[model samples]
Target chain A: MTKAVSSQPKTKRGIERRAKILAAAEQVIGEKGFAAASIADITRAADTASGTFYIYFSGKDVLFRELVEDMGRATRSQAAERIATAANRLEAERAGLEAYLIVVRDRPMQYRIVEEARFVDPDAYRTYYSEFGKAYADQLQQAAERGEISAGDAEVRAWALMGIAKTLGERFVLWEEGEVDIERVVAEAHQFICNGLAP
Target chain B: MTKAVSSQPKTKRGIERRAKILAAAEQVIGEKGFAAASIADITRAADTASGTFYIYFSGKDVLFRELVEDMGRATRSQAAERIATAANRLEAERAGLEAYLIVVRDRPMQYRIVEEARFVDPDAYRTYYSEFGKAYADQLQQAAERGEISAGDAEVRAWALMGIAKTLGERFVLWEEGEVDIERVVAEAHQFICNGLAP
Candidate 1:
C-alpha cells in the first residue's frame, strides 16, 4: 500500500497564525471604526499574507459580527452555568453581573463591536442581545416565581435590570482604564438592583 | 449715495441654511447609515443648494456632530426645566421621563442621530449622553438630599433609572410605529422605577 500525503498543514503554528489575524482585526476595528478598516491594513497588522486572511474570514463584516456573537454567547453561557448553581436571588444576580463584567473586561473589542452592531445592523443586534437578555429574564422570572423577589411583571423588570447593569458596566466598570477595584463596583450595583436603595 | 446694504443678510441666511442643513442631515443620516449618506442627499433633502451646505459644514461628519450636539442640548434643556420645577422625588422622576419621551417622540430624527453617534463617535456620544445623564443625576441627587429617597449614591441610582427609562423608550415606546401613547408609557416607566414592583 502507498502512503498518501495530506494537503492541509497539521501544525499548531497554522492555527496560531489564524488567531493572530483575528486579534489584529479586532484591534484595528477598535482603534479606527470598523467601517473604515480595510483588509490590507488588517493583513499588514497581522503580519500575514493577504491570501492568509481569506483562509480565516470571508470579509471584515463577517469577522466583526462573529467576534461580537462569540463574546455575547460566551458571557451568557458562563452566567447560565453559574446562575444554575446559585443558592438564592442575591447570589444569582451577583453571578450574572460578574459574568458580564468578565466578558466585557477580557474582550472589550467584542463589547464595542456588539454595541456598534446596534446601529450597523439591528437584526444582528436583536439576535445577539435579545437571546442573552431572554436568558437573564428567565432567571429573574424564576426568582420572582419562587417569591425571592417582589412580584410584578418579571419581564419588564428583567429588561429594566439588564438596562441598568449594562449602563453601569459600560460606564464605571468595563470602560475604565484606570486603577480601580472592580469587585466593589460590581457589589454596589448588584445590591442596588437586587434589593435597591430602600432600607 | 445709496445706503450700504448690510453684509448681515448673507450671515443671517447662512445661519438659517446651516440649521436647515443639520435638520435634514439628521433625517438622512438616521434613515440611511452615515456611511451610505452623501452631501447631495442631505442638501436635496434639506431643500438647500449643495453650495450652501459647504458654507456651513466641511462635510457630513461636521454636520452630523453638530446635529448630535444640538439634540443633546435640547434634551438637556427639557430635563433641566423639569427638574427645576418638580415638587418631589416621584414627580421629578415623572417629569424627567416625560421630558425624555416628548423629545424622543417629537424629534425622531434627533433620536436616530444620537443612535448613530453612539456607534461611530465615542467623544460625541459622551458629550451628548453624559450631559443629559448628569442633568437627570442632579435631580436624583437633590431628591436624596431632601430625604425624598434613600441616602445611597444618588448619581449611580439616577444613571440606573435613566438607563431603564431610555431603554424602554428606545426599545418599545418611541421606535414602534403606530399609535404609541407616549403618556402611558412614561407613566408606567415612572411607576416601575420610583415605586418598584410593590403594588
Candidate 2:
C-alpha cells in the first residue's frame, strides 16, 4: 500500500485510465518479466501516454508490488466465495482447491507475476503468502474446535494444504493446454485429504 | 542439455574450471537474479578470465539451465539415498521430507535458482519437476500395490506430497534463521500424511 507515487484518481476518467494501465501492465510485465519490461512498454500496451504510467505508479517496482498484492486480493476473495458454499471444513478444502485451479487456468499470467514477486519484491512476496497462511491457519483452528477436522497442528496443516493446491494448479492447469479435469483431480485429492495414506 | 554454445570440458583442469564457473554463476545469479547478473560478474566471482566462461558455457541461458539440471541431480540423489533406508513408503515419505528440508537449508541459493528457472528457462524448470513427479508417482504406485499405503491416484498424491514437502521447506526452513527443528516438523507432517485430517 505504499503510494510510491500517484495519488488515488478522483475523477471517473482518471480511475478508468489507471485501471486500464494496470491491466496492460499485467500483460506486459507478465510476458516480458519485471526486468526486461519497461514503463514505455507498459504504457504502449495500455495505449496511453508514457507519462500516464507515472501518474498511476511511481515506477516499475511499485507497479510490480501492487500487482502481487492485487493478485493476492483477487485469489483470497475468489477462495472465500467458493469456500462459503461448502458444507464443512472438508468440503471447503475441495471447494478451495477447485477455485484455486480455476483461477490459475483463467489468469495464468497473474499467477506467474505473483511468483516473480519473490525475486522482484521479496517483501511483498513474503507478505502475500504470510498473510494468507495466517488467515488459513486461523480457519483450520476454528474448524478443529468444532470437530470439523481431526485436531492437529493447524499451522502445519494450513501450509501443507496450500502446497497441495498450488502444486496441482501448476502441474495440471498451467502446464497443460488441454482442458483441465479439475473436478477429477479435486475428487481424488479430497479423498487423500480426508483419509491418510495409511493401509 | 541444449548446448547453446560450449561443449563439455575434456581434461580434469578443464572440468574443474567449468565447475568453478558454475558455482560462481549460482552465487551471482541466485543473488542478483538472471537478468541483473552479468557474464563479467560470474567470471570475476569465479576468478577466471571472461573468455574462460565461453569455454565452459555458451551463454547465460545455458549456464542457468545447467544449474537447474544440477540441482535436480543433486536433490534426486540425496532423496534416493535417504529413501533407500526407509522401512516402507510411509517411512520413506518422512525421510524424503526431512531430506528435502535439509537440502533447502544447506543450499538455499540453489533452491532459489531453480525456482527462478521458471522465468529464465521454462523448459528446464518444467523438465526438472516433471521428471521428479514421474518418478515419485511410480514409487507411490508400487507402495500402494504392496499395501504399504492406501491406494489412490498416484500422480495426484505424488504432487500433493511433493507440495507439502516443498511448501514446508520454504516456510519452516528457508525463511527462518532460528533452528528449524526439522524432526518436529517431519513428525507432525508424517501424522497428517499417514492418517490425514479425518477423525
lDDT of 2 by residue, A67-157 (tens): 8888877777888999888999999988888888888888888989989999888999999988989999999999999999999999889
lDDT of 1 by residue, B111-149 (tens): 777777876666898777677667767766776787876
Candidate 1 Cα deviation (angstroms), residue A136? 2.6
* CA lDDT of every candidate: 0.71, 0.89
What C-alpha lDDT does candidate 2 achieve relative to the native structure?
0.89
Docking class of 2: high
Please provide, for model 1 over A17-131, each residue's C-alpha lDDT reduced to its tens digit, 9 standing for 90 to 100: 8778878887887667677888888899999998887766766777777767777777878788878988887677778877777766777777777777776557788777567
In candidate 2, which residue pairs clash? none
Candidate 1 chain A TM-score vs. reference chain A:
0.83
TM-score (2 decimals) of chain A in model 2: 0.95
Q: Number of the top candidate by lDDT?
A: 2
Which sections of candidate 1 miss by over 4 Å?
Answer: A1-18, A81-85, A174-178, A197-199, B1-16, B80-85, B174-188, B195-199
Error of 2 at A63 (Å): 1.9
Per-prediction interface RMSD? 3.0, 0.7
